[model samples]
Target: MKNLNKLYILLFAVLVFATSCEDLTEINEDPNRPTEVPVEYLLTSAERQLGNRLYGGFDNVAFGMTVSQYWAQNEYSDETRYQFRANTNNTFWSDFYTAINDLQEIKKVNTTIDKGQQGINQNAVATILQSWAYHSMVDIYGDIPFEEALQGVDIPSPAYSDQELIYSALIDSVSSAVAAIDPSAPGFPGGDVIFDGDLSKWQKFGNSLLLRIGIRLSDVNPSLAEQTISAAAEGAMKSNADNAAIQYITAQPNVNPLYVSYVVNGRQDYCATENFIELLNGLGDPRIGEYFVPAANTGTFEGLPYGVTSAVAAGISRDAVSQLNPQVYAADFPGTLMGFVETSFILAEAASNGWIGGSAADYYAQAITASMNYWNITDGNAIGDYIAANPYTEDNLKVQKYIAMYYEGWQSWAEIRRLDLESLPAANLVEIDPAVNFVDVSNILNRRLYPQDEQNLNGANYQNAASNIGSDAYDTNLFWDLD
Candidate 1:
């Protein structure tokens, strides 16, 4: 009996020792802070990041709106003068790649575990978003680390791919994404913040994005442009219902950046540009009221002079200049990634370019109609009258497109650069008062400077890119920007 008791004690001690070893092995693991997560969480993050970065804050307000001359600084007018923050370039580059890397991971995850039609749909969605992010990066930086990007330590110093090559790949990627999308299948399980698990809308958004991408090559590769645009228009966003936008709710950490910038932060740094206000007033455009608020002191829709000296900007009272409209800075304003209004304009341009079989005038009218409807201007008479007044000349279509791209600063800036729209910036104001600390606004920023971090960390590759692109200056134009 004593021998039996000794054996039992020994077994119990062994069991305890085994349990302690198991616990020690799992000491690094934390259930609350998981290393691996469902792809749904990643989708939500990537979509949100893309929407915010493209639609507002430094990318939109300072770089896009100011550079596009839609808005100008009321006090510090340096950004309007083409003197952008270096850190912003770094942040913008990082923001895009981070979202893109997350998207790539989603694709990887889908391939590994959920290898079914649902997984295919998820992967397709990821590919479309990745293409969009890459397209934006190439559009801004001209040449960027693609192909080899997101390879981790395998290729830490990835070579910058030519913008032309990058665009070609993006075109293929978008096409594949569209084809792969099975709208009938379950998508993303949950956390699809943009369209709420609607794969059909995702397909349409992809095609619309593809359409925009094709139109961008109109100047550089017309044949490819025609072919791609023709194919994409067949499946592009048909109405406001199909628009790809992130509708921000009145919640902490998820509110629209415009609200955070103008309301929460209580910043009065920006005002409507004199050029923009003049354009609106000249046309009697109703969107003027939709876009800007009346001057605080004057109660008139006055504008601040764009690209002027800081001294000149400081002289203008903040209360005397029109700030962005309240509705724009409202908590619930949708941050549009791509919309029917934009796709309509793209179709119009394609039609005008003889790339597609549609009436340019009709498409142009539809674009204006879409824009009006989007802004809650639903009167039939008002819509008809506006469309009629703005006919379908090439210049008219481009100008109207510019007008419609009010809040989407990046797209506006891209259009401004692509079309070289001299009319919008009023002679593209050359080095305003050269005697003062001047930023050369003569040539609207052709391309953003490469991130300073790239130079420091990826020095050799950065040097090669700068050399290959013929200097990393703002004057360096992307391949598509060439006439």
Candidate 2:
């Protein structure tokens, strides 16, 4: 099953049309047209693409699955693949700006969609989606083309805005949009790829997204965090059923975005990481069955040992081992596509720390239990029981969170970069000797350097972006990662 479809995004680059003044003038051109091409279509398209692969450098799947603490650390040569770096092959900024342009176009006529029956909710949904795009864009590339971004033809050569501004905007935008959702609205879109366009569900999505943004600001702004979590708890997801995940069709050109490369194309390239697998297995957790292929025909589930060395990598056979593969991917696999579980987990952490006034352990247990139930593995076991039976030490929390975050994006890696989770039973191939570095923390890699294109397409600007953050490659940390 080892083949080559994952390279599609790596090899293909989208040709964005030059923006014309008219194109940027309107966000939605039509009020009622099934399959109608609207200016604001880009919002939906970009949100969906968040699940799809854009380029070699910005794959949420690979980064979340392989690089982050949730999964394996590469046995290959470069940790560049494990963390964020300016990749020569990635075009995330271009993709984001293009989407931004589309969003702006839709915003121009966004009010048109606010007709009698279900106008308010429709507008709110659109706003919520746009907020998601902005958050995602700046999270990957700090200080991106914001403010002037998504302005369509308004500003062709949009200037980069500080990442901080983008984050701040998301907080306000998502908050306001959520407040506007008319849950009782009768008229909503007929076809929704995610959440079936249910206004209530959209409200939950908006609230959950708010919770995510709140947590992102925890270390930097505790006051904001406390306030935001309080609001998040009022409307965020209550169960796995309320998740804001999009369901990709398995139909041609519509299959689960990951399917095109990992399954149908015949290339079983990516697999579960040893670090991810070991932690779950050690806890006697059941999610392994849902996430990985049980070692294959011979029937052994091979869970790899984490932080294995190059020599150790050679020792593990690929036979029916405990590992995850895309082919065996289930419909309900604990997913990275934002959901109630993640939102709950964030709230749980907030409450636990007293950053907000709620039960931390209660939220934590709910998050974990909901996640387990998501995999259809409800065996009468509760998350509290599991945590109590097991040691709720720092390491356990790290590993548990890692397991909970499978298939999520670089957030887990961010957690590792910022917080020193009690050590895992794994080894790190530290580039700099701990003794010589003289730094308190041993060997830790932060932000990824600018990809090759920085020196090519946007050379001067890339250098500035790199310098702003301190490093253009993987060795440097982001402004937010400062502990």
Considering every candidate listed, which one attains the maximal TM-score? 1
Candidate 1 local lDDT, 289-340, one digit each (tens): 8899888898878888777888898998888889888898888898888899
Top of the candidates by lDDT: 1
Name the 10 consecutive residues with the lowest summed lDDT in model 2: 74-83
lDDT of 2: 0.59
Cα error, candidate 1, residue 146 (Å): 0.6
Deviation from native of the Cα of residue 467 in model 2, angstroms: 2.8
Residues 283-312 of candidate 2 have per-residue lDDT tens digits of: 767787777777664674555443444454
- Predicted candidate 1, C-alpha RMSD: 3.3
| Candidate RMSDs in order | 3.3, 13.0
Lowest summed lDDT window (length 10), candidate 1: 423-432
Model 1 misplaced regions, further than 4 Å: 1-20, 26-33, 423-437
Compute the lDDT for candidate 1. Answer: 0.85
